[model samples]
Target: MLDSLLPPLNEHNLPYPDTIHPIVVHFVIAMVLFAFVCDTVSYFTRNPKLAEVSWWNLVFATVSIFIAVIFGQIEAGLAEPYDAAVSTLNLHSILGWSLSGVLAAVTGWRYVLRLQNKPQLPTPYIVASVALVGLVIAQTYLGDLLVWVYGLHSVPVVEATRGGQL
Candidate 1:
């Protein structure tokens, strides 16, 4: 049974070399950033039209983030972190979960603002969005460290894991 689970692979390997988390996550990151930008610009210009763009982006990102986090958790679990990578992996995991909650809460708040038919986002909410961006930047850095620095699911790591040597 275990043998069947662990099939042989070549350098050409599993659909992609790494986990699918990053592929999905980049969408969330882009959406969140763009949403914030739209909101900020609309706020300064007092053009409510951009709010529609921001709201839709936020909605899509809210849904996409969960998908990204699910894949992230699964991939993180499967990662065979070396001693040096363990701390980084743990930080990345913690930040990913934290960001999920923050993103959901902000989405809910935005929904409320939408319901209220406000002309623009409240200053506080915009500030919160700025903070969210900061956290996201930090999260991106950590994720990069894991994949680029630690090489979590790189072809070599995958090969080692498949061979029970990771």
Candidate 2:
């Protein structure tokens, strides 16, 4: 019924040229990692400019993650994931949502520190940033497993599922 309301799906089962989730997600990953880099570098160099850079990166990462997760949910729904891919997809989705909240919370804390013009990052913020990077790494691994290992949304996977081969 919903199919009638939308344009035809592509080979990847999306209504557009390609999956948008990954594209947006890469930006989030880059920003998140770069933010951590800036923070760490600032920590050692005592440069306020790097802190400002990290702050902007965190702010953008917080915003872009939501967009990534939204498109991720949409694409995951249309993916027609097979049995082998289901668990990973579900985990990825759960982590994706969890990361959104985590990113927001970290950003909020960072904003508070930024407002105070704190020169050095507190130990607690460093700890939380480390944890956030760990989560992002785990999420990236799961995402890779989904596409590279389980082949979710790949042409062959889509075709096989349609033909009952998956």
Candidate 3:
């Protein structure tokens, strides 16, 4: 069983370890979660004193999204061609990019609205944050689907059989 489980290491076609991909995904997810938490807390607390700090949270999350996009691109580049799971990976990449763009734009808009003292800024901020959370959920789900359903670039398994070396 142990022998069947461990594929011999080779130079030409080295398999990427499963652990790294999920770590990257989790990092991105954490960014989104932190953004949501900060936004929610700020909204409820409504302490004008913390306004600047709360805004910084969104800024930091936006930066993290950029980092995640880089990591996602690297992961995709490392993926093997002919893998049936590429479809989900492709979809994940597209959605992740779209989410990052929207988040960045919204964050910038919020900052502008803050400077302008726009009366309706709060409502738009709330709406944008909710949309970001929804996008995060969708992105996470797509990642899960790639792993569980598509099995993209997963380690190959070997089965033992009664016949000779099968």
Candidate 3 steric clashes: 0
For candidate 3, write residues 30-130 as lDDT tens digits. Answer: 76667566656667776544455556766777887787787667656654534456677888999989988987887788688669854333766778778
Error of 3 at 147 (Å): 2.3
Q: Report every candidate's CA lDDT.
A: 0.86, 0.94, 0.66
Quick one: best TM-score, which candidate? 2
RMSD of 3: 7.3
Tens digits of lDDT, candidate 2, 53-140: 9999999999999999999999999999988889999999999999999999999999999999877999889889999999999999
Off by over 4 Å in 3: 1-21, 49-53, 81-84, 116-121, 157-166
Q: lDDT at 165 for candidate 3?
A: 25
Q: Cα deviation of 156 in candidate 3 (Å)?
A: 2.7
Ranking by lDDT: 2, 1, 3
Q: Which stretches of candidate 1 lie over 4 Å from their true place?
A: 2-18, 159-166
Per-candidate TM-scores read: 0.88, 0.98, 0.69
Q: After the best TM-score superposition of candidate 1, give how far the Cα of residue 52 lies from its true spot, in angstroms.
A: 1.1
- Which pairs of residues have clashing backbones in candidate 3? none
**Which pairs of residues clash in candidate 1, taking residues 3 or more apart in a chain or in different chains?**
none
Tens-digit lDDT track of model 1 for 1-166: 8767775543424434556899999999999999999999999988888887998998999899999998888778777677888999899889988998999899899989989987778999999999999989999999999988888878777677668775
